[model samples]
Target: MISTDNFTIDSTKSKAAAAERFINLRQQKKVKEFLVKQRGYKRPDFNRMILDLSRLKWTHEKIAFVLPVAGASTVSELARGGIPNFEHGEALIELWKSETRVDRVPREGEWQTYKYEIGQLELL
Candidate 1:
């Protein structure tokens, strides 16, 4: 007979199981599969858009007006990382093109934000 009391919980295995479950739950909440397939984006591209728009003094209010994907509360978060929603990226692309009079998105190579790092220099 198998005894239930004889088994010991392995913490590493337990943590791994928990992480897998959490990932599954998160995946369920992701944007629609077909939509994501059609309009997904790379992280760096979104980051560049946020930075450029911010420098151009485009407010969250303006962005949200065009697409509900960007909200005021998430402006800093999106700027620091990215707006995950494809709709927001599309709207921002339009805004950038019209305001900057440029009809292009940053390419993988052109997404290089900074040439040199201030942190590399020794502190005075």
Candidate 2:
């Protein structure tokens, strides 16, 4: 006959097991995959875009300000090669495009100033 008198459940062990199970379930559901499937930018492209924006003097804070879904930390991560979700990626690209444009043509006054500066440099 089996003895059941000494058998007891360990609450700590059961709790640990439950936690492990939860973690495993979470790991199996990769949200990044879903985001990618929904047209998120790849890591490389995202990183390149971030770098380009940085070259134009766009700081992490500045980017985060423009992207509704991102904070400074998120912007920093994205700048350091992290991939952005579809919406954020598209917004970043649009921000880059807007910043890259010359808002207006340089007038004659601006051209004359530039020409004078160049002439002064040539005299050196």
Candidate 3:
């Protein structure tokens, strides 16, 4: 149960630092992709954990180095409709807690399956 709200600019920056610890995992030849689940639970208490996987999709086009592909698609759809969307960012935070791996590439419409965060962007 990680709350995206708790991750301030500083915490997000920290996560960026922690991201370095995972670069090697992605560089491995056997690793087709990799995903780092950095999440937190704050309602009852603060519980944080990081899951390092061997494969993931680097969706740098939509969000940061890591995020949900489906969530990205949803935002793209919303943006096409001329509405602001940030669902993928929230899903990334929640996925960090519950999801342990990125075994397969996310297909379209998958993000709607989860009620989580969206894009991480400053409104223009």
lDDT of 3 by residue, 33-100 (tens): 33232132112111111111112222324333355554545434433432223564355445544443
Clashes by residue pair, model 2: none
Candidate 1 regions with alpha-carbon error over 4 angstroms: 1-44, 112-124
TM-score of candidate 1 against the unseen true structure: 0.45
10: Cα error in model 3, Å = 51
Tens digit of per-residue lDDT, candidate 2, span 34-63 = 776867332334554565567667787888
Off by over 4 Å in 3: 1-85, 100-124
TM-scores for candidates 1 onward, in order: 0.45, 0.43, 0.17
Task: Identify the candidate with maximal lDDT.
Answer: 2
1-124 per-residue lDDT for model 1 (tens digits): 2337867667788789999999997787675675677575534355566556656677776666665563665655666664456766677677766655555566344554434222233111
Q: Which one wins on TM-score?
A: 1
Tell me how many residue pairs clash in candidate 3.
14
Compared with the true structure, all predictions reach lDDT values of 0.60, 0.61, 0.36
The regions of model 2 sitting more than 4 angstroms off are 1-44, 101-124
